[model samples]
Target: MSRKASGFTLIELMITVAIVAILAAVALPSYRSYVTRGRIPEATTALASKRVQMEQFYQDNRTYVDAPAGNNDTGTSTYFDFTAAPGGAETRTATGYVLSAVGKNGMTGFTFTVDQSNAKRTVVSGVPGWTDTTVNCWLTKQATSC
Candidate 1:
């Protein structure tokens, strides 16, 4: 009696590998974009919380300049470096503040900014759906208008 092959042939294995390669190539960028989008909230939340604290400081100190400058990560994020702008500058007081989160580690090509007016902006260029200009909309992975 003749027996047939019990395993995949070389041609079939090669085709499978090619299919996987193509799938990965297509999915990788989308996955990366999704991850980057997921990390955006870290910046937004940190900025929003800091904004509240700065407002409180203003309520007590009557200035946004003296509200201390530093990372306010709360040990929850590792992708971006947070900063409260105009922190303790010679001005001693600022009428407005700009909170920013610069991408760190492997999270490059993204910079998020928010001001006292709550105007959010993304300062990244060449991103698939992101604008390089300062927009009134929140910095998100999706292309949106403010």
Candidate 2:
């Protein structure tokens, strides 16, 4: 009976390992960027949903001053303080919504900004490594865009 080869040569195995390492090194950052990009939509969707809730609060409570009651699963039963500066928690007023979607708390990424009064929204990656911007792709109501 013929004997079968049992294992790879050391050089061949090393080369394969090195190639895989190189590919991973090249792909990791890109993958992270893609992930971060995906998160932008998540954050924006969350913001929009929150805005709708805030509007609903205004409709039901007749004022935007009170934080809504909490829901266990959604994590959005309360109002986000829109009073924070550009990159803080999303804020909403009875008349409009204002907030940023990324790069919060020193996170390095893009951010979504919505200035309801001007009907302006944008995505900004503040620095090259930090994608900071607004998600301006979706909008609702004349008072806001984000």
Candidate 3:
């Protein structure tokens, strides 16, 4: 009498492996995007906090220049670099200031800004599964506008 094998065959194992590989290929990019989106809060919240500081500075000094010490810093966040971008020689002016948070490490291609008008902008996005959108607002997720 012929007996049936009790274990999975090589074809079955290969099929399972292929399925796992395909799932991983699809899931990894999505998971990466989710992680990147989580980091976006760091930038938005930091910019909002800085805006508050700038407002307080304006209230005290009547201008946007000479922000308080360490006011421009995005502390302890490894995903972004903060700066005052400039078209002219000046970044901070009596009339206004522009704060920028640029992506770093795993967050490359992402940049954001908030100016004196309280305008929030997404300058660019390099996230694996996200569109930059730049819809005159901060993008906290892929294709979703804020």
Candidate 4:
């Protein structure tokens, strides 16, 4: 009596592995880009909200200097570090301010900045396919306009 193989043959298994590898090769970068894009709102929202607070503080104190320090909504961000420009310069008090979010961890190589003028800019250097210029453009994975 002859019996048929009950399981996949070596060639069939190899083909399956190859298909999975190909799929992963296509999907992985896309997934990373999506994740990076997701992290951007954390920066933009925080900066915008801080801008409001700074404006309020200016209304009360008549200057941008010594405005209350802004905190990251989560206390600690996973992908970026938020900072206010003109930080702690006792000799000079800023009439205008720039808030920035610098990428961290796996998100390193990008920086987003917003100023009192409400201008937005991105600086991308270490990331591939982007130049080092700090261009006035919205931050995106495509690095378009910059």
Candidate 5:
């Protein structure tokens, strides 16, 4: 025998590239979902803190109407837009109110709500690979209700 080729053939290189592509295709979505879930706690924590603030205001005013206008943000978030609910300047009723967080940036298709009754819920999502239970619960994990 003379000598074997020391370098990879064109076909071998193409096969390696194809394998990498398949791995990436499978991994990218899982990594993206994990990142999304990480950002979600920010919204929930802000909402909880805002709820406490609302309760304090209610204790003093005895009505949710004076709590905060709908345009006033409960708190700041980079990945979420916090609105007092209804996303307008209208005031809520004296006995009840709702606060919601809408996703921003790369977090579209996510909406979370909390009410004066402390009810937490995640709206049905339109995102691919996400399954919303629509059961009046927050989804802290992938397709899992909280």
Candidate 6:
């Protein structure tokens, strides 16, 4: 009489499990890294957008402004939305970019700053309507190079 084969042997099962585990081990980290790299560009775009908004605001207002209200709420607003965007949060100093991003603690981190001497532009934050973290947007002046 013919008999059905038994379940897989221990060695076969172990080999399959090991193969799956190995594949997972390699895939997981690579996936995470890919995601992280993708995010960096989003952040960079956000920052660049902020700089553009600053320039536009300067032209309209004739003065540098900070985190103007309604920029995030309304598309017409000439300000960047760092929180909504990817640069985290940032500001423009009179002589450089004062980019800020919230960190692990209550403390904030400075991403980077482009000094006036190098870019021939002024960047400042903490203006009448601006805050360190909330200063995601900025307004530039007509005469100012931004």
Q: Per-residue CA lDDT of candidate 5, range 1-146, in tens? A: 79866999999999999999999999999998899889889988888887888888889988777665335663467778887777543547778788888888777778888888999989746766788546587777776565
Model 4 over residues 19-105: C-alpha lDDT tens digits? 999999999888877877787787777777777987888788888776764433335678778777435323125577777788888
Candidate 1 has a TM-score of 0.78
Give stretches of model 2 more than 4 Å off. Answer: 1-6, 60-97, 102-107, 115-120, 126-146
Candidate number that wins on TM-score, 1 or 2: 1
Candidate 1 C-alpha error for residue 96, in Å: 2.1
Please give me the total number of clashing residue pairs in predicted model 4: 0
Candidate 2 residue lDDT tens string, 23-104: 9999997775665555455555655665566566667877554434112122332222222224233344455545444445
For candidate 6, write residues 31-79 as lDDT tens digits: 6545433433433444455556656665676544353420332232223
Quote the lDDT for 4 in model 1: 81
The candidate, 1 or 5, that scores higher on lDDT is 5
Off by over 4 Å in 4: 70-75, 86-94, 128-133
Off by over 4 Å in 3: 1-5, 69-75, 87-89, 144-146
TM-score for each prediction? 0.78, 0.53, 0.84, 0.84, 0.83, 0.51
lDDT for each candidate structure:
0.70, 0.48, 0.78, 0.73, 0.78, 0.38
lDDT tens readout by residue for model 1, 77-107: 6987776544423433467777777777656
Global lDDT for candidate 3?
Answer: 0.78
Residue-pair clashes per candidate: 0, 20, 0, 0, 0, 10
Clashing pairs in 3: none
Which runs in model 1 stand beyond 4 Å of their true positions? 69-76, 86-94, 126-133, 144-146
RMSD of each: 3.1, 7.3, 2.8, 2.8, 2.7, 12.2
Clashes of 6: 10
